[model samples]
Structures are given as structure tokens and as C-alpha cells.
Target: MSDPNTADCDSNLHASYYADGMQQVETELVENEQIAQSTYRLRVAAPTIAARAVPGQFVMIRLAGVNAPLIGRALAIYDIVNNDQGDPTWVDLVYLQKGAFTTPCSQSPVGTPVSLWGPLGNGFDPRPCDRLIMAVGGIGQTPMLLLGREANGAQAFGRPNGWAKDVELIYGARNEGLLAGVDDFRQAGFDVQLCTDDGSAGQQALVPAILEQRLQEIGDTASVRVVTCGPEIMMEKVAECCQKHHVDCQVSMETPMACGIGICFSCVAKVKQADGNWDYKRTCVEGPIFDAGKIDWS
Candidate 1:
């Protein structure tokens, strides 16, 4: 198999290379519907951004012609669809209304104009694996939906065989009300295992516990690759579990950013090196996706 880091580095270069050449565009909002408690699915007709988007990549968006929010919000590209001519027609984003920007952004009516830029950051690359396991918690489930869709579609095209034929998603939330898109994932042919802390959903356990148990069940850890995104603590546990099982893992880190193009240096993460060295990498450009083992959990 090729070096995962090399692939990711190449991806980073590509994002930066393209981003430097593309201009931000004003797009029209098509939908802004609440899917779960305080969470919404925002769809926009952004042909340029949509055309360049890759699953796990994101866009920086703000209401067009408005300066009240002051800065754009970095949102994961939840989904992308193409028109008959093979041109991208729409882009989707899933966000939680938790702050000054997201609150009003979520409340914006359909047909409102917004500015968008990207297809930014390195995305997940699930190569050379016999099974792909996705552990998603809270809003971190956003990127996994697209990844699962891609993996499922690839399997149908005879790209991966055996257990890899179906992507397994271990989704967890605080309660049943916070769980979103259970049916959508199932409909997409992913094997979904829903977990909720309050026992109000499919299983009563934290996501990491379920993942640990599942890893033990599989036993052959060498063939499995784990991908996780959520709160830092939860991802730390997932990383530890994958390390213990000798399985490779990747994690998507979430951080506050004023600029999605890596200029502000506000979204930096400490990365651990092979020889016990550490360095900071910008999440907006170098990642949002990174090797779980290389992350400095401390």
C-alpha cells in the first residue's frame, strides 16, 4: 500500500494549489431545514464549489453582501450532486446552531444569497483495507455520510471485496433526538449501529465502547481501518483502542477557525512524529483529517 501520509500530503498540495487559483462565488441557498435538535441541513446552488468538492473537504461560507457575522464559517461538505452534463449542481452542509454566525445562518430563508469558497483540506483516503469502520459522534457524523456513500458506491463497482463490500458506521449521540439520518444511511446500504448515552436508541453505550467491542469481535485487526470524528476526548479513546488492536486509524479534528485557507494559524494541532518529535499543522489546509496515531493526545 502507498504511504497514507504521502497521499494526504499530495491532497493538501492539490487543495492549496487549486484554492490559490479559484475565486469565491456568491451562491443561492436552496434549503435550510432542521434535521435534528438545533442541527440543520443547508443546501446551496454552488456550481464552482460543488464541482471541486470532495468528501471530507469543506467550504468557508457567509451570507453574501452582509458583514454582520464578520467572518465566514468553515463547514464540511456533507454531499455533492451533479447534473446531467456532469457538472456539479448543488452542495450540502450540516451544521449546528451554536454561535452568533451559525444561529442566523441556520435561520436564513431559502433563496438567500451566500458566499462560498473551497473543496479545501485533505480528506479521508480509505485505501488498502479489508474493512472500513467509521465511528461518528454528534455532528461529526457529517463527513461520514459522504464517505460511506462513496465507499458503498465503490463496492458496488467491484472495487473492494469481502467485508469491505459494506461500510460499517457506529453512530452515537446523547439521545435519540440527537440521532440524525439513521434511515438515510441504511438506505445508502451502510451497516449502521446506532448508540445513545441515554439508552433511548439502538444501543446503550458510548461510541468508543461499541468500537472496542466490535474490534474484538473482528480479531484480525490488521485488515481493519478505523476512522473517527467527534469530541476530542472521544476521538482520543478511539485512537487508543485502535492502537491497542494494531489497527490503522484516521481522525478528523474540529477547531475554531477565522480563515479556512490557513492564513490565521488559529486552527493548529500538535502532531507527533516517529522519533518523539512534535510539530504544529494547520487544520484548514494540512488537515481536518489526520492519522490518529500521529496526533498528540496530550
Candidate 2:
């Protein structure tokens, strides 16, 4: 058998090969993410996503229009759940169609084939944690979905008392209409809280406002930790909230990129290394994820 990693091996190979590797040749377009804005949800045909993807991992994509002017765009894997046949896990990539690549890709039919190249970079570290607090804003909620799914899984984050407790996904958007993945999150048994700016949904303010109320309601505990991913400014505010309350927090940061690897300095973000040297780390490789305190987000 030939590896799907290599696109196709033998010129003489049978037509049924690609069909037999249906798991490797399938794709999805504009489902969950699009519900938020002009977003698109893609199911990539990669073993890398199914076999190896962990929480907060990302993938590189090249739509016809994006590469010529800029380069391939990188998007986080929102979720990695099994498709209907249950043989392969379809990766969830949630992206807005504002840019050149995404705008074109969004126009393609649902079954259109697109080139995908991930489960790239180091994902979140595995732990036996039973409680999870996730904060999200704008389209940044994409990565947290995968994180939430892992925590919701029966083995890694299941309750010892046989009842789920303290797994909350707090989101902030413009309105209830702008909220994506509401059902996906709710179906996973996550406590969902939405704060809309227009007072159209859950609460009317920023994510920090709702999160503050949550912490006030639950009080502090060593077992309580936060994982945040969003715009740079929003993440900075979240860091402040965690710091004031002394809750451990990790944040995923976004930077402009032309290459989704370390060779180009485009995706560099400032972080302090072990030796105390302040340096720039590649977001494409070192992380789209990092310790919130490690960087000067200002």
C-alpha cells in the first residue's frame, strides 16, 4: 500500500486507490465557521490531522488567489472529530472569507478539493486535568474548539465522580447571530456563556467582564486554570485578569506570516527564552500558542 502523505506514487496505480483512501481524499467547505460571519469550515484530507492532531494545532492552506500576491495562509484546527464512517477524523478549520485566499475558497462548492498541509507545530501539552476554562473572542474561538473537545473526551478529562463539572467555554461576539459553534460546544456538555456587544445575546460587554463574573461566582482554586486564544489586545486583557486573580493562564497569539515555517521571519513574536535572553520566536513553529507572561504583547 502507498502512503497518502505522498500525493500519488505510481502512474500505473489503479483508480480505486484514491477511492480506497477516501479517508485521505475527502474535503469539507463552509459549514460551522460560516455561521459566525463570512466564515468557512474545511475538512482536509490529511492523515496528519486524523492520526496526529492534538489540541491547538494548525494547518497551512493555499487557495489559488492567496499565494500569488501574499502566500499560504495558516489557520488553527478548530476541532478534530470523526466523520460519519468513523474511519477518519475530519479537521475543523474555521476561517473568515475576508482575505484573498479565503474569499475565493469560500465561493467553491462544498465538495471542491483544496490543498492542505498540517497538524503542524507543537500542540497543547497533555494533562490529567478535570476542569477547563476557555476564553474566546471574534474568530479566535476556532482553536479553543479543539482544546474543548480534548477536555470533553471521556478518558483525558472525564470526572472521577462520574459527572462532568467545571468545564466552561466563555465567548464574546457582536451578537447571538455572530456566534459560531454554539451547538457544537453545547453538545460537548460545555457550559456556554456569550456576551454580545449589542446586548443581543447572553451578556453585553467584553469577554473579560463575563469571565470576571464567572470567577466571582466560583471563587479561586488551585485546580482552576485558563486557556485563552483571541486578538492580541483581547489576550493582553485576559492576561491581566488571570494575573490579578492569580489563576494560571496560557494564551495563543497571532502574527502576520508569509511562510508557515521558521525560515521566514514574518511570523516572529517576542518571548523570553530559558537563558533569559529576549528573542523573537516563530509563531509558525515555536507557536501560535505561548505562555501569556512570556511575551510583551503591547
TM-score of each: 0.89, 0.81
Candidate 1 lDDT over 1-298, as tens digits, reads 2245543432323223224423487877899999888889999887877765656778889888887887889888887867799677788888988998889988899998999888777777756566789998988888877777766663211133233555899999999988876776787787899999999998999999999999999987788888999989999999999999998899998888788887787887877655576666778877888889888877
lDDT of 2: 0.66
Q: Pick the candidate with the highest lDDT.
A: 1
- Model 1 residue 50 lDDT score: 71
**In candidate 2, what are the lDDT values of residues 173-263, reduced to their tens digit?**
8777768878888877788988888989887889987777777777854566778887788888888888878777788778887766545
The residue pairs that clash in candidate 1, if any, are none
**Alpha carbon deviation, residue 30, candidate 1 (Å):** 0.8
After TM-score superposition, the amount by which residue 140's alpha carbon in candidate 1 deviates from its true location, in angstroms, is 0.5
Residue 164 in candidate 2 has what lDDT? 25
